[model samples]
Each structure stands twice: as structure tokens, then as C-alpha cells.
Target: MSTAPETATHFRPVPVGLLRGRRPAVPGPAVPAGTGVEVRHPTRLNAMALDPSKIVGTAAADDGEPRGSGHPAGELFVVCDLFRTARVEIVPGSDEVTTTGHCSRPVLARHAASVMRELLGITDGLLVHTEGVDLPPHVGLGSSSATMASVAVAINELYGRPVEARRLIRFLVDNHGEEIDGRSDSLMPVQCIGGSAAAGLIPGSVQVVAGNAVPLLSAGLPADYRIVLAMPADPTEWDAQQSLQEEARHFDDFLRTGRRHAPDIAYRLIHQAWPALLEGEVREFGKLVFDYRFRMGSIKNCSFSHPRLLEFADAIEPAFTNGAADVLGLSSVGPLFFAVTRTEQKVTELFRDAGLRTFAARPWSEGYSVVKSW
Candidate 1:
């Protein structure tokens, strides 16, 4: 049995400048307002899952501030960057709600419309266009949440900014899940919601403390760190013909295990991982990250066990030996693997040598900055 440390009661914010890597410059001409608004949200890797009951919850969705749930809960995630982006464009005053994009998913567009209708209580004529780095549809990496977050930010911008940053995160958690469909698709999409959702929607590295109110803080890591994603070129798909009952059973079992194991999971995430990340202890941080992934993998139906992933891990083993990269682990519900490294060059070379598609991303510091406003 492992000893647990004191639970985190409050969030400690990190200085943005101290975080490693430059946020990639967003592209495209500035929005002139009347035409439309374009927004970019980053993809995330779940480092750990915090017990839900520990997260401070809002009395109601609209109240906005987080308060304790006063009961034990399960199903919250601690996330980091993969750096792939989901970009959305909203052109309001259309004839009806229309969504068009190269990489947009039907469920995502559906949720975006639903959120708009629920938030505004009306959706007569709104149009949303989304497209982004072609993220593998269902191998985790918080694609669903990222899509929803991109659309949410764009919609929030269209509506004259009624939802504040913190409140916006609550919106993404409203639903989350997935197997071949995605990670968050298994739950309410809440499990996939993390610092990436907050960062992309609001624009900063948000550390969500799952307690009474689910407190979120803007935290940063040292500038010397780097995140590299080893994404598989092709993703396998689940048969749509598979019985719904089987799927239900799979999810049910997964949830039950998470609940039963919540305490241990929560302790590692809040007590161990949090401090390592905060203080910039790279190897220790990586070890805790490995521990988190290992623990999650042990859960039935939750394992990301794949031969290709292991092969990739083996291929990148030398980086650890030479101290180019400090740690490596699976990215949330992934076929996408990640490595925490000392430099960007090491990450690039390793992936290039393996011939796997790679993406480089830094922790976002600004929660949500309007790139262009009319």
C-alpha cells in the first residue's frame, strides 16, 4: 500500500512567463466583426483523474463559483497539452443553425448548437464553421472537448461575451466520453475536460482542483520543459454495428472501477503529481505521470494497451538514457503517446527517426484572449 499526502484545498497560480515554449502564433486575418469570428482551442492529454467529489462544484450552473460537493465523487481529469488545434468560425445571423467544417464531428456540432440554445435560450439563425489539425477521431487527446471548447469560445464571442472564462469550463463539463468515438464520450465529456479545455476556451494553463467547488487556477511549468506527441498515422475504428448493450456494460464497469478506486487515484493526482508539476521536478514529475498512467491502465476496460504504442515507447527509450527527454506516457485514452523532454529538438528527432506524426505544444498561459475583435 502507498501512503497518500495531504489533499490540495486551494489552487496556486503559476507565472505565465515561467512556462516553457512559445504559444504558436494563431493564423488568419483579424476578424472585422460583421463577417465572423475565428477561434482556436488546443488539444489535451489527461495526466491524471481526480475524484469528482473532491472538485468544488457550483450550486447551479449559473452561479459560477465552485463550492464543495460535500460527498465523495469520481470522474474529473488533470490534463496537459498535445498542442494540436481545433479552430472554429462563427457567422451569426444566418437563416438557421448550420455547421460546416472539414474535420467537424456531427455530435460536436450538435452539442455546440445545444449549448448555444441552452445558453441563449434561442437559436434562430446561427452558423458555425470548424476545421483544424486532423486529430485522430477517437484515440483520446481530448478531441471532443477541444472541438466543443473551440465552438464554445466562438459562440461566446458571438453572443457578446455573457459567459466568463471560469464559467465556460463548467459548460464543457456538462457532457463528456468514448471508445472508438473518443475518451470523454464514455462519461459526459467532463472526464476529458481539463486545463486544455479551460486554456483553449478561456486561454491559460488552468489547474482544476477537484474539491468542493472544483477550483481552477492558472498554473505554469518551467520554460525548459517540452511536450511531444507521437500520434499514430491511422486509427482503428469500432464497429457501429456493435450492440449498445455491450457498450453500456463496458462503460458501466469502467465507472464502477473508477468510483471504487477514487481515493488512491485522487491522492496521487492531487497530493503527488500536483507538487511535482508545480516545482518543475522533471524526472519525478514524469515518474508520477507514469504512475498515473499505470494506475489508470490497471482498470478494466480503461487500458490503452496497444502493440504500436509499446513499440513507439521502445523506440524512444534512448531519449531517457541520454537525458534528452525525462518521461513518456500514454495521452488520455490514447493511440497518441507523449514525452516530457528537456528540449524541442530531442522530441523532433525521436519522432522523425521513428517516422511517426508528431506535434509540439507548450502549456497555454492566457486563458482566452480575443485574437481579433471588431
Candidate 2:
């Protein structure tokens, strides 16, 4: 059993510049309209399943009503320093959107077209090009969300900054069905707002309500903390064969029979883990993160469906036990597992020794920003 702190000596004051209750103003491009706009959106790690019930309910109806039942549940996430870049430009032609580079997925092209028609009401053809980090898709890095966010921000910029970040977030969340393929969590508000560099720690927990990402707690990790990621180069057969509809069915199964742990998960996130993060208690936060992963009903089912993921989790368990890392867990339904540590190189080497591909990323402090406009 643990007791609350008796004194203020142990915790640092929240950084004044890091407070983030309100939405940050979206920055505008200096370049004139119709110029090519490029924006970078950061990737994220779903640190814990705050509410498994909300995962399937993220899709909105044609009338913009959220499609699921139950009270909205929050999620714990970390914005990784990795980013996907998107550039959008208007072209002379009929009303269609085409994508090039790593973002050639038809779903993304359709999303761009929808955003354009819905927001600016332009019918002109547009070109969207994206550059991705060296990681593959569907490995739990939030790559698709980042790419879509980048494209959405670029489209907004290309049309003279008509949408604010919050409205843009709602639009994206409302139309997620057009982009997402399988059953997965809703488009996190963090994916659209990006991490605020000025917010220091970023929003450690958030709940998606009516397509808005409502921040529950905002805090940062200790200055010395780092995250090391290891992703298996190949996905399991179950992961590979899973279609959007199949994934949705999985969510349905969880809602029906697997959500018994939601209460425990919520308590840990709200009362335990969140406070630990605020006080810069990395080890405590990490322990909660590690435990929270298994507490997620969907992720527990995933461990059985994708047993290879468990093998990877097993391979890295010694690092936490030995204290080389402070935090350890899978990122989303993953081929990717992350260890939070002060010893980045050591943990990264451990993953490599286990025959996994690895990278080290800091907690990104800033959200998406316009990188170039011309």
C-alpha cells in the first residue's frame, strides 16, 4: 500500500509556460493563397487504454453524432518526436484529389477531397505528397493519423487558414470513417492538435467527446527521460489479415465481454499514473504504464491473437526488472514496444540484441506546424 506525499519538497512546480487548458492559436503561413503548403504532424504512442469502450465508438454518424454507447473514456498518449510530412497544392482540373509519395493510399486522397469540399468548397484538383518516417504502417505509431493531420493542415493552409485547430479536429474525427479501414480507436484529438512544444509535458491524458479531444491532465516527463522503441520487422498473420470490419468486430467483442477491467484502468489513470507524471515520478509513471497495457481488454485479447507480440514483450521484461528502463509496454496493438529510460542507448541495444529494429525518440513538445509554404 502507498500513501500520499506529506510535503512539497519532492515535487517540482508546474512550469508556467507549460500550462495548456486552452487551445493554442493555429499559426498562419506568410505565403499567399494557392501556394503549395507543407505541414508536419507528429506521431504518437497510445500509452494506455483509458477506455476500451470508446475505441469502437469513435466513428460519427452522417448527421455527426458519435455512433457508440457508454460514457466517454480518456486515453493516455505520448507524442513521439517522429513526424510525417504532407504537402498540398491546388492544380487546374476537375474536383479530385491525388496523392503521391508515401501517402498514395486512396483513403487519404478521399479524405483530402472531403476536407477540401467540406471546408473551403473548392472543386479544383489537388495534389498531396507525404514523406513518412522509416517505420511501416499499422504498427501502432499513429502514422496514418499523422499523415492525415498533415494533409488536413496543409489543405487548411492552402485555402488561407480558414479552419482553426479545434474545428479541424472535429472535422477530422467526424469523417474518420472515410479514412480508417478497420476497427480501431477513434482519431485522437492529439493527432490533430499535435503536441505543444510550449506545453512542456503535453496532455498526458485526454478523452474524445463529440469529436473534441478534451484534455484531462497536462504534464511532462522528467527532463532526462527518453523512450526507446522496438518494432518487429514483420507483422503476425493475425495482424496482417485483420480488415477494418474484423477489427470493429473485435471491439464489439470487447464491449460485450472484455471490458470488466475498465474501472481498474480508469482508477489507475486518474488517481495513480496521472499524479505520478505531474510530480516527475518517472518510475511510478512507468510502472503504471506497464501495468495499464495489460489492463486494456482489447490489448489483452491482442496478446492471444498476436502471440508474437507477447514474445517481444517477454524479451524486454528483463530491462525493467533490472532497472535499465523505468517504463515498458506495447504501443497500441503493436509489433512495436517501447521502454522509457534514462539509458536510451542501453535499452535500444537490448532490443537490437533481441533481433528487433529500434529507434530512440524524445517526447515531442510541439504540435503540428507549417514547415513551408510557397
Which candidate's TM-score is highest? Answer: 2
lDDT of 2 by residue, 91-172 (tens): 7654666766556444554454454444564566777788878665667775655566677677777777676655555454
For model 2, the stretches where C-alpha displacement exceeds 4 angstroms are 1-34, 56-73, 101-106, 177-212, 237-241, 245-253, 256-258, 295-299
lDDT of 1 by residue, 256-309 (tens): 445666777657656776677677665665665555444444222333334366
Give the lDDT of residue 329 in candidate 1. Answer: 64
Question: What is the lDDT of every predicted structure here?
Answer: 0.49, 0.56
Candidate achieving the largest lDDT: 2
Q: Candidate 2, clashing residue pairs?
A: 181-244, 182-244, 195-366, 195-367, 196-365, 197-365, 197-366, 201-220
What's the TM-score of every candidate structure? 0.67, 0.74
RMSD of 1: 10.6
lDDT of 1 at 246: 27
